[model samples]
Target: MTEAKAHIVAAVAQLIDEHGPAAVTTRAVAQAAGVQAPTIYRLFGDKGGLLDAVAEHALATYVSGKTVAEEGDPMAALKAGWDTHIGFGLANAAVFGRLTDPARGADSPAAAAGLEVLRARVRRVAATGRLCVSERRAVELIHAAGTGAVLTLLAMAPENRDLGLADAMYDAVLQSIVTDAPVRTADGPVAAAVAFRTVVPDLPMLTDTERALMAEWLDRAAGA
Candidate 1:
């Protein structure tokens, strides 16, 4: 994306994050981005288009920041992936909610990309010999559990949003899975290696440029 387009998308994301999706008007985005409203319409087509763009941009941004080294133990990779997933959710709660909202449509490219990330993580876990048995089922369960935990946190406290709650929920879910796994061991390092091998490959892959852009985004998100 061009600098201009990226700015507009970032502006829209910020608007939605601060004021909810309902507040994401072209005029508002234009004003925030320091561009004309007509430019937004010309580039994005309509509000729906702009919304889709925002969603896509957000997902791409989120996926880019996630880093799991190829050489790490499987269990460590899984923990890192889980941490990144929940951290992104907690850091961008409103954006996270917008992606999952039914209003966005399940078939939307943004939603598909989001699901792809989860599926990729599952696949990575299966690549490790530790989860050789029932790998498919295990991946599916992990994805389901993670999603459920996030949604449950949101549902439980509609009025009070807490980043800690998201972390706690995901930690519990991950702990449960790790504890029950056949490969789990009493040794922390060994357990992490097992988890890392099982979960790292299941994540989305991004090019170097995408990763740099995502890193910039996370820096901005932190400062915001």
Candidate 2:
């Protein structure tokens, strides 16, 4: 985006931080950004377009600053990503709400990026042979748990918020995803299916056609 566009988004985001989403009128944002209301329309097309731009800007900025411990354990990296996600939600409630809101979420580029990050982390875990569920299933479960935990926490007053809820949710998701090993172990039948499915294409004993068919069977068996 151009510097002018960035300035306008920044001004609107600041207003959201100061007075919540309801206060972000075009006139208010234009005044704060030192631009006229027509400029916002000319640049963003409409209020909804402007709000979408703001949500994209906020999510992209947050994701750009996040780093997981890639040199160490994948689980640890996943945990770091989880903590970062929760922190971003709490720090930017309006943006988080906009990203997760059913009306807008399907079209939100940031939400898709966030999910892609989660999928990458889950794939790392699956690579270690420690994932007890299909990578796709694990990603879904973790994403759902984290999003629900953040929204739940946001619903309460700051002083009244139960911080443990996030940890507990993480624990629950971890139990469902990981096996009982320091790093690599297949724990159950479903997990076996999930793990085997991940490498089915490379199974030397099976022909290409056989591998393809086996993958379909394992995917179903893995609940994916």
Q: Write the per-residue lDDT of candidate 2 for residues 1-224, one digit (tens) a residue.
A: 89988999999989998998999997899889999988999999999888889989999887777654456788889998998899889988887877788877487666777788888788777767678778888998999999999999999999999888999999988987888763423336776676667667668999988998998898888777
Candidate 1 — number of clashing residue pairs?
19
Error of 1 at 214 (Å): 38
Per-residue lDDT over 5-96 for candidate 1, one digit per residue giving the tens place of the 0 to 100 score: 78889898888878887788767888899999988888889887777777778878777665545575666667567667666665666667
Candidate number achieving the greatest lDDT relative to the actual structure: 2
Each candidate: RMSD to true structure? 11.8, 3.0
The best candidate by TM-score is 2
**After superposition on all CA atoms, how large is the RMSD of candidate 1?**
11.8
TM-score of each: 0.61, 0.85
Clashing pairs in 2: none
- Model 1 has an lDDT value of 0.62
Regions of model 1 farther than 4 Å from truth: 102-124, 158-224
Each model's lDDT comes to 0.62, 0.83
